[model samples]
Target: MKTESQLNIIFVPYLSPGHLNPMIDTARLFARHGVSVTIITTPANASTFQKAIDTDMNCGYNIRTQLVPFPTAQLGLPDGAENLKDGTSPEMLGKISYGMSMLKDPIELLFHDLQPDCLVTDLLYPWTVESAAKLGIPRLYYFSSSYFASCARHFIHEHKPHERLVSDTQKFSIPGLPHDIEMTTLQLEQWVRTKDEITDFMNAAYESESRSYGSLYNSFHELERDYEHLYKSTKGIKCWSVGPASSWANKSNEEKANRGHKEELAQEPQWLNWLNSKQNESVLYVNFGSLTRLSHAQIVEIAHGLENSGHSFIWVVRKKDENENGDRFLQEFEQRIKESNKGCIIWNWAPQLQILEHPATGGIVTHCGWNSILESVCAGLPMVTWPMFAEQFYNEKLLVDVLKIGVSVGAKENKFWASEGVDAVVGREKVSKAVVELMGKEESSEMRMRVRKLGDASKKSIDEGGTSYNNLMHLLDELKSLKASKALEKTNLKI
Candidate 1:
């Protein structure tokens, strides 16, 4: 058997923050367990988490990142516009995607050159499955979301339940899932509704998972035990659930504060002090992951809802062009909230993990993105789920229905960030009502107790002799064994 030091693995994380951050944390966790780890990404993407990697290196972990030049000039994009968050327009978004596609050849060449024992890559890069096979190494597919979402999607794809629906608004139950989950065709991605370029691309990625060595989830057993079992038994694949990965990797407050992006609008102390003044479980933390873009009307509704709810909140507002009519209104609203000290508006990035961990932060108004849901669960906070797109609607089902740890904001339709229009907006009444019920109702305490138990389980699952810890050890052993068997096959061919 190869020692942990001898086993080398390369991680290829997608350029977006939600995908990139957790994969980097998982890579660092592998390094801590004595594996030699290398992450390959474009320079702009590397900058997001290089500080965390440098800290691990300084602590004597064998982890480092290799930078690939981004095709900014070729794609006609700005120098640092390599991440999904950087795509401000449809044209820019296409360019960033094309830029990512342009890297496949060079990245595959690196795979051949590095000769690592295994490759762990994001679900977006289906091409890496073939590259890993060519190198005679196992490729582990890193799924940044939950098992429940995966299982829900699987059943939806398998049964074509949405195909039988008469209209996009009609609800259909996904067949063969562990729980009775209902979704409308509108909640599915645009690709799922019709076969297009993206449908083909996503299909290839999901097919690649079945062809890979196995899959890894950023979830624990207790969180989705039934769905995990259903996923494995139905798919008939080897998998591991080693998660709450962010919590496992970023233990210190300093690490949590600086987890993802390097730039921050205000220093950590500024927000920390704001939270300190609030009572325990008094403030609502509102952030729609990195990708969701709200229209001006939606923003106004949110502002009014929070104000009407009569609750304290800290909302992270993404920096965008202020040419819209709502900009002046937002400025006036910000001024009013600032004077009242009822709300705090942070422009651009906020230290999400640290804010979630703060005692004074009571609940979250989330986009139902898996990472945000996991982080909120770790903080033992119930959610006001407002899923925008992707697998988020599926995740919301897990939170609101299966887990009973969240209250839905009555969002009925699903729309991508760029395509969000007046048709998709949830009015102020729903928003205010959900927030009030989540933070003030008697049932809120029961939800908090249930979520706090899950939070405790998340911590225990990553500790020594825990499920996730053992799963990591077993995965390492399996990788070593696979490497050894490949070596023997080559020796036999020579003989």
Candidate 2:
């Protein structure tokens, strides 16, 4: 184990809102618990951090942020670089390499100057781990993902190296993963295939994780008990599940629009007003998360599916092109919606947290990213999971099969590569049936109650004396112990 030291914890993330949000919240929680924390992010994200700091400052937190220089290649990324139209594994590898190379020196200098007792960072950026090791800081991986997703990523790293590319048969079932959880080749990211770069990156990723001697996952152990054993046994690092972290991080003051960029970027009231008119558990909030995009055909298919389902819904469609004719497709969609006399509220820019928090939100049609999953769970809503790529398939499996908290879609066919922007079509009949089952059926109602109970437990865990809260305290004390040990070591060395 790394020796005790005063925890001057430094956290860094690869550029993305999803990665940045939870991490910033965790930092705040640490600061609240009396750990001196500094967040290193790009200038692009500094504003978001500033708002959060202001909010915390008002509530009396000392969490600080420093805008590190962004690597030149990272500066001009499209709105969603992770979901780029021309994304390839090789290209992503080069981008990550370049980003790390740019971030390392500045980060190392800061590590030396700040002299943090420990370092916590996102799993994707291996360079941070290398930097932490060089500085002799105890590094912890804060995976902003479910236990299932983490397990799958680990499985992908351990096996599938020589295979180069994942075949459909190859992902059927792994020896180490949970039963009935299917991971297909198409759902696997390109990072899984590149032998040299991916392996090297993953080795560093694991090494950093190993050095941490512990991890903080954004999930509860009860929800993932089966997989938790494997997680513990494999890494040999203490795993602390402290989530639905997103909800714990939520400011709860919808009135305070000054805390984050989401407030400026979205109109929370518009979503809430529509929800107010709807019945309890009557509306389904549809979104594919920030990183997933749909093609025209898939969009039409989803439109028709919602229309046929005869349910009211608030659909969030994030387009790369929000030009004058941005919502040109809505004209056709409205006609179909009018025929059914069902409600369809389309927002290119939707207030996700506010919408999820609304009482009318009974179900979520989601991309099963960890944040979206945690948000849905916190909202006490069930999911109609449409996992796109990467570790989402694993998250989807946990939701639908293991936890029975959501309905699963998107793995039966390989529509991801069929065309650009085209979602794998789950035709109107299947979509209608699934929604009907999720919204009106007895089975669906039971699942709704199940997730509600889970939500309550999540809240309890993060509240005073709850599992998550207690875990956070333990982690803080652990850092303190390290701090004391370091002081003692220096004293003995002088003797």
Candidate 3:
């Protein structure tokens, strides 16, 4: 089974933008390094990766897509509602999880036919571990969060420090991690609190991850060298922190140091050109990734905050979100901002990477999503943390506490702003101050320098002979060795 014809790998991503994007980047990374990569996802999610896959193939890299029908009818979901981003409500999100779980049989069959050298999958597909084992292939669990979050989760699972606390709102120290990070019980994920169906799924996922050959994370060693080493020492899992995976997008342009950020550029060429016309480090970029909905009050506050901060900004307001409370208020505010000519409102879907890379961009007001965090680091932009849900609060801790490159807008209570009412809206005054501090203050100059250094390190990480580059090479060698050993065992059994 060990063929010297280039190594082939299968990547199975969960049906969420947060999960699929980084894994797709990692798949492309492998392809650029001479590995044959096939990314398998539902038909609905397939289009998101198709353009990148086609681009890679045209460049003569071995990358392709395999689409399976999502169980929309079986799961009572609407047509084409395969991804979490498609879910209109929390109840629908639960349905998406149910639908993803139903893919076990189909994925197993595909594994039987593809017979890849190794399996790489999102943590959601726990059954893939068994599937890989059945086919005599190794499995690597892909974690798309920060090493700090990983270290916290790993320790929290082992220790149960929260059990001793009385209230869910009470703050507690995360035990066993190298960092002195403290998060409220409220900030901890819902699954981490109780034993529900979601908890059950997570337990199965963690069990499968532990049983697999190793874990792969979208982080680089230099970013969290201490937590990186601490994770391996504590978990005893063969782990690879060959990431800041957004950097992988640049690996193909080994010649042009500029082409890696092209994936998101073509979507809005005009906006990028406009951003370039602004002052250096003068434009504050505000975007709450995709899926975090904002209430009317929240949007108005941010509008006033950005205007009051007196910094030119490019704020991305998702078109769907504009209809959430009242489009009139948003329209009026947009007109005021436009007349002032200090702000640009992207109705929906702007070129995020290109805007981030623009020289005029100074600070970011982000939801603290891990992907955004890595991208911000790559661009060397300081941030104003506004975490809305999930492990994003943990990532905020890394940004504000460990990295010291951000100021929190102080969203201490953890709840999805999508349904959580107006209590979550950070006041315009706080937002104004955070923006002013990040974009103008002398003290914030340290944050600017620190983040720029991280940006440099991130760029260095994927270049030839870099930390992530070597780690990726080592992972490939491990897979090849495992393949040869499996083939030897197969031959011996035949004898």
Candidate 4:
């Protein structure tokens, strides 16, 4: 194996914080290993990009970024649309779809100007793969999701559109997927749902995913061994699950500041102080992730559940109140807490990774987003999963069904109750039971052991001489090997 490196990779990610974080972290990893990287993304997400760039100094890698100009106005989004939290909206989705078209030309320009060795990109961006093929650069798909999500996407594309594809109430097992991954329409997230023309669009994206050279999942092979051979054999693409990438990015902000970077460390001293007062595994860390929003009544129910459960908890509430811009939700939530006097700390945001890594953190009560799920797994924390939408339901299945790593908050039955802002059908009794069970020593310890073991395997997979490390090497080798092929060098459209 060649020890020295000579590759310059262009990193492109789907412009969301959850997607951007892991991609930037991977770029840092490549940089740490002596490979040069220039990240490609829109100017809309410049803040997170800046934060990521600033944070990279601590990881011992610094990479440059080229912000592409996007038509933010045409999509009916605000001037700073990228900064807006990721949510389900037709307008936002349209902007992304339109921006993707614009990205094609910009990416082509970047490829011509940079002449980078390879393109490392999210599988969702079709233009990246197309541009790489036209420019004859090897493109490796950097999936910010888990192996289960990747495989499911591929399966959905390869198989013809079926009844379940359109049906919301059907629960069925995927033909080749592991375990009895029983899934229902209520459990299906947005990505699995058929909304307007998105189904056809996603189908095309999946097709692109199937045609890539290789893939890198933000997970360990041991965590999803059932699909290892299937992922490899499907596209003849090298698949590597090297993840819990957070461990690599969690270095102290002080170290980063020492390297000419200002640290935006989480203001977590208050929460930590609270944790200090609790018994080990006693506090339930409640967060709905970065993107999910709850209506006023749903927030109250959550408050009710936390209050009735009679546990000292930290709840991260993104307040949604027309009267006061969500601050009211927190205020009302706090009022309930005060009346009950249960010692619940209500915050709009928390230091998610630091909180998860804290020894006193017992379990995560989450919205079941993959990023949150992986972070929980990486931090060796079990979950009380309340999935909102998108691939989250699928992720919830993998977590609760296959891995036994978490529990799911089932769906709401009454449409009016849902319209009236009910977060879960799980009443106070179920909530208390889930809390007791999740916070129980035996269940928590078992889940912790499994998650910690997976976390360790994830670290090893990314380390030198590991399965994922070798896969990256092999991918680079294949890309380098294709560099001089006359067939690939031509600028003619072959597809």
**Judged by TM-score, which candidate is best?**
1
Candidate 4 lDDT over residue span 87-149, tens digit each: 345466556666666667777898889887788888677667878887666777777776776
lDDT of 3: 0.82
> Candidate 3 residues 339-374, lDDT tens each?
888888887666567677778888899999998899
By TM-score, the candidates rank as 1, 3, 2, 4
- The regions of model 1 sitting more than 4 angstroms off are 1-5, 264-268, 418-420, 489-495
Better of 1 and 3 by lDDT: 1
Ranking by lDDT: 1, 3, 2, 4
Per-residue lDDT tens digits for candidate 2, residues 1-495, read: 122343678887656656767888788778777666789876656765577677677776667787775554444544333222223334563564466566777877888887888888887766666677777656778888877777777776677532553464455554477575656666666566434686576667766777665788878755677787888998788978777666787756552333335346455455566678788788888887655556566666777788778888878765552333436776667666655546655554565777777778889888777888887887788998877766677788788878898887544433333254334566667777777778885768789889998888877878889878887888888877876887788899999
Scored by lDDT, the top model is: 1
Error of 3 at 271 (Å): 2.4
Alpha-carbon runs more than 4 Å astray in model 3:
1-5, 251-270
Cα displacement (angstroms), candidate 1, residue 25, comes to 0.6
When 2 and 4 are scored with TM-score, the better candidate is 2
CA RMSD of all predictions: 1.9, 4.3, 2.8, 4.9
Candidate 1 vs candidate 4, lDDT winner: 1
Point out the higher-scoring one by TM-score: 1 or 3: 1
Per-model TM-score, in order, reads 0.97, 0.87, 0.93, 0.84
